[model samples]
Target: MLSLRPGSSGSLAPESSGAVIHPSAKCLIKRSIDILGALVGLVLLGLVAGPIAIAIRLDSPGPIFYAQTRYGLKGKPFTIWKFRSMVQNADLLKQTVSNQAQGLIFKNENDPRITRVGRVLRKTSLDEFPQFWNVLRGDMSLVGTRPPTEDEVSHYSSHHWRRLDVKPGITGQWQISGRSAIRDFEEIVHLDLHYQDIWSPWYDLQVIVKTITILLDRRGAY
Candidate 1:
């Protein structure tokens, strides 16, 4: 078994201490895919996201972008970026509304804190566009498991950590399968493990196709 210790930066390091999984062929290929997608996504961002940013600014009094720490591959923490979709101090008000989700997840389908522009952004998944930058930075995949927040990760058992063995994604089985329709976090883990276990370029393609279809139909979006 490979043992790990905290590095000077406070992130986990393997016992080998020298070779990270940065040079493997699979890793390189995955990075290439991410880079290509991010480049193309940047074009779309230029065309669409600028107006969305303006609309968000006009509708709310907060930063246009929101970054939250999320657990990535092997439980490493990285900041996940999204368009600000809630009130300026939404985090401070999270406890004001009870979580409607099951397990460690939090959800409020009718969260009063959501702004008008924010509602449109979430419904269209436009709020997710900034994550292409995350893909560019090698912090996320185009398709994988949902990135869990630090608090969510804190509640994870050993079995629940399996989803973190691979990079977190912009969209995954969780999004295409049901998204807000999914109430149980265990079911999300189940779908995520299934994707991780059966992952392939073809599987990624299928999920992307499904995601595009769902987005066009605006199905199961909160």
Candidate 2:
């Protein structure tokens, strides 16, 4: 089991208690799984990506991609790619619209910036399909902590920053647990740390299976 300590500011504390190294066998196995799973997903999705791209282009007047700066492993910065799901300049327009979710994160179920095709893509989580490429490129894993935006990264306390110690992931404990339903940033950090402490190839496989169910049910996604 993992330990959780309270930070000086009362938020969660970073796992500064020294590194808990995973077995080399576990690390190699997990990486192999990530590579193989991502490859298969990319091949399968490739067949459908063209039609989706066309749909997005027809429904919106913006570039086909949405790239945002996100924090990756060890708190490094990387750009995360997604099929553009919002209108051009959506980032600039975020402040002008009313935010629907609680805490530091922003989520608006009826965000005006979303295009018609974007709504479909978001509902099916097709927007995230592009991230498989990130996994292949080694910027992300098939499962781990969801990468935070650069702005969100800035607000993290040292404890919250523990999520950055590992690679940013396409999906993780948070996504399988509740995703947008889990509103507290502190709770999110706690879950991410839990993952870091107990990570295994089997755990990743379990999360992937659960994610498929969650996607099909579409619970707590938005």
Candidate 3:
């Protein structure tokens, strides 16, 4: 299993993931762009949040948002927020259903826990709006790697933990490539670490552009 140690300030210490992810000037540029994009998203959220919340309430008996613990930069824990797209007891129901995906991840294309409104929220990616708050709060980047749940992290081999060297993202290569259709978890790690290796402001912009295209086309998204 991967090892992690908390920074003195209670954040992730730089060396926690067993590799030094050198901070670059381009990284700072990427951070600036993230802030701008997140601010716009939060403003948009203010307009759509009420309607989405009401729809969720009418379709399901659960909280408007689902906040789950996930590992962010350097395997640090953070709660990722999304519009509730599953039943209240969805987490508890995980083990009862056999996983349909490969390599330690649980995925079911037809998971019964999904709500009526949830299906729409997921396909159009509206369930991702709440994560703008996380981006604004600096818990995530606008583009990077996907965040993994603590349970998923717990099972990661040390090499797999390298993906956590950078901040997680609301959209990335994985989402744009195959999104929920991806089966092998290794494919995801490959793309994420590939991003880590070739990360640049231009690349991030490219990924963001492709992500918009994917959202509009609703390709491969659940």
Candidate 4:
């Protein structure tokens, strides 16, 4: 479980307390880029959302969108939106499935909870398109760390909280660095920290470009 003891500042400190690590967190230029990128993404989403919605409706019986709470910067909770890619009762049935990945995060590439349409959505990452709204709303960035669920963060070590210093992203080190293949949560934390250490507008741009290539090829996604 996480060390929730408050620091002198009355806020929980990361396992290894350190100064703020990401310049992107406070950069007005980075914020501007996020806004622009999110707008473009929303436009693209607008174009495809209809067909995707129809497909989901035909493929399963559930709402068109799925809204869930996710932890963001400093472990703040916010609603993250996605296209519904699972059965309506998937969350309720979570315990019925086994977690293939180790540590705080959970993953199961072959999880039976995923619908047939969900599989394609996960592979193509179309399921993530709705999160552009989160970026536009400032709950997320165009590039940063992956947003963690409450269950995952509940068990975080003090060091694990470091990844939450910046806003969560629709695409980041985890998405580009083998989403499902990299199952170990510690590796993900390493990638998240590495992203913060090396982040610059140029670096974010590179990651975004590489992400596009990966998405186009449908590589390393589900």
Candidate 5:
């Protein structure tokens, strides 16, 4: 089990002073797969990025990409980029919207901030394409825990910090296991910890396959 405490910088680190303790944190095979998979994903993103950009531009008046700070491994902050899927002032208007999900995370199935094009992007999971760059840059893995916002982690309990033991992922157990339907943050944490408990290259491959299947069936992302 990994024990974590908040760092002075607001990040989480191992409670004991030593090399990183998470098994996946030091796995060369996983890193190699992250790199290879990210490369392929980036190529696919490039093929569709133009069309997506055009649609976003025509449907909304904002930058094609939206970048926001998200917590990565050990609660470290990094900029997460996605195709802009909301109005220009979506972040500013967040407080006005009610959070439908329970616990720390926030979600609204009918969020008014989402533009028409944004809905399609989100439905297809194309909005998440740019994170491939994060994977290539080592800020994220192809499969890991869902990256939390700084606000969400602000209220995290010590045990909740354990999920950050691995790098934040583009898709993970939470995503594959009915993400939109799972309203409780603790359940998501359980799945995150479960992934760490079962960290294996084969398991990551399985998750990748499942994610693809969900996307193909149009059953992922809302």
Candidate 6:
């Protein structure tokens, strides 16, 4: 469980750390790991991706991949990619449906937009594989906070904006902890800010390990 620290004005500090370090060095180290890890993961998964792409095409009528605009470091916008896991018109359909999760996040276990293949991809988290390319491109890190969608960003308070102080990530504390199970927007913001406050190369490693375990268990994955 994450322990929250109190920031000025009753805002949550989000993460625990014993000391502060130079932000530049931290950025360099984190980027180096992202590049190295992404390169290696791509190499190892290269063979696997081809068949997965074919399966997706066979299972769905749309493109094999999907991309959406998301907020990255310092609130910059970038396109984040994933395997197409819903009907081509899913976004257009969302407005007509009732959302299942609380606060600014939307999650419905019974969402009708999910394609047949999308269910498997989401369960295994294979949909997120393309983001390694984003990591390589420096639009993201291997670990930090999950990038918020533009709609989600629009709802952020000033305290929540603190999450943008670091690059968005492929996985982070919230992911490893409970992911979609976390319904409160403030809790998600707290997790992101926590990651920023205590970030380090070692912390990245820890989060990655936890991510692997969470993925294997397939817990809290929609």
Best model per lDDT: 5
Q: Is candidate 2 or candidate 5 better by TM-score?
A: 5
| RMSD, every candidate, angstroms | 3.7, 5.9, 2.2, 2.7, 2.9, 7.1
Candidate 1, which segments miss by more than 4 Å at Cα? 1-9, 12-25
Question: Which ranges of candidate 3 are over 4 A from the true structure?
Answer: 3-19, 22-26
Which pairs, if any, clash in model 5?
none
For residues 1-222, write the lDDT of model 2, one tens digit per residue: 133454343323234534433342238787898899889979977988899889988887888888987767655566788999999999899998897655557777788998898888888888988888888888888888878875675556657666766777888999988887787777788898898888878888999999999999988764
Compare candidates 2 and 3 on lDDT and give the better one: 3
Q: How displaced is residue 41 in candidate 6, in Å?
A: 2.3
List per-prediction Cα lDDT, in the order shown.
Answer: 0.81, 0.77, 0.84, 0.86, 0.89, 0.78
Q: Give a tens-digit lDDT track for model 6, residues 140-172.
A: 888877788867766565566667677778898
Over the stretch 182-217, how does candidate 3's per-residue lDDT look in tens digits? 989999999988888887888889999999998999
Better of 1 and 3 by TM-score: 3
The C-alpha local distance difference test score for the whole of candidate 4 amounts to 0.86
Candidate 4 regions off by >4 Å?
5-21
Show where candidate 2 strays beyond 4 Å.
1-26
TM-score of model 3 relative to the true fold?
0.92
In lDDT terms, how accurate is model 1? 0.81
Q: Per-prediction TM-score, please? A: 0.89, 0.86, 0.92, 0.92, 0.93, 0.86
Candidate 2 residue 107 Cα shift, in angstroms, is 1.6
Off by over 4 Å in 5: 1-20
Where is the poorest 10-residue window by lDDT in model 4? 5-14
* Deviation (Å) of 113 in candidate 2: 1.0
**What's each prediction's clash count?**
0, 1, 0, 2, 0, 2
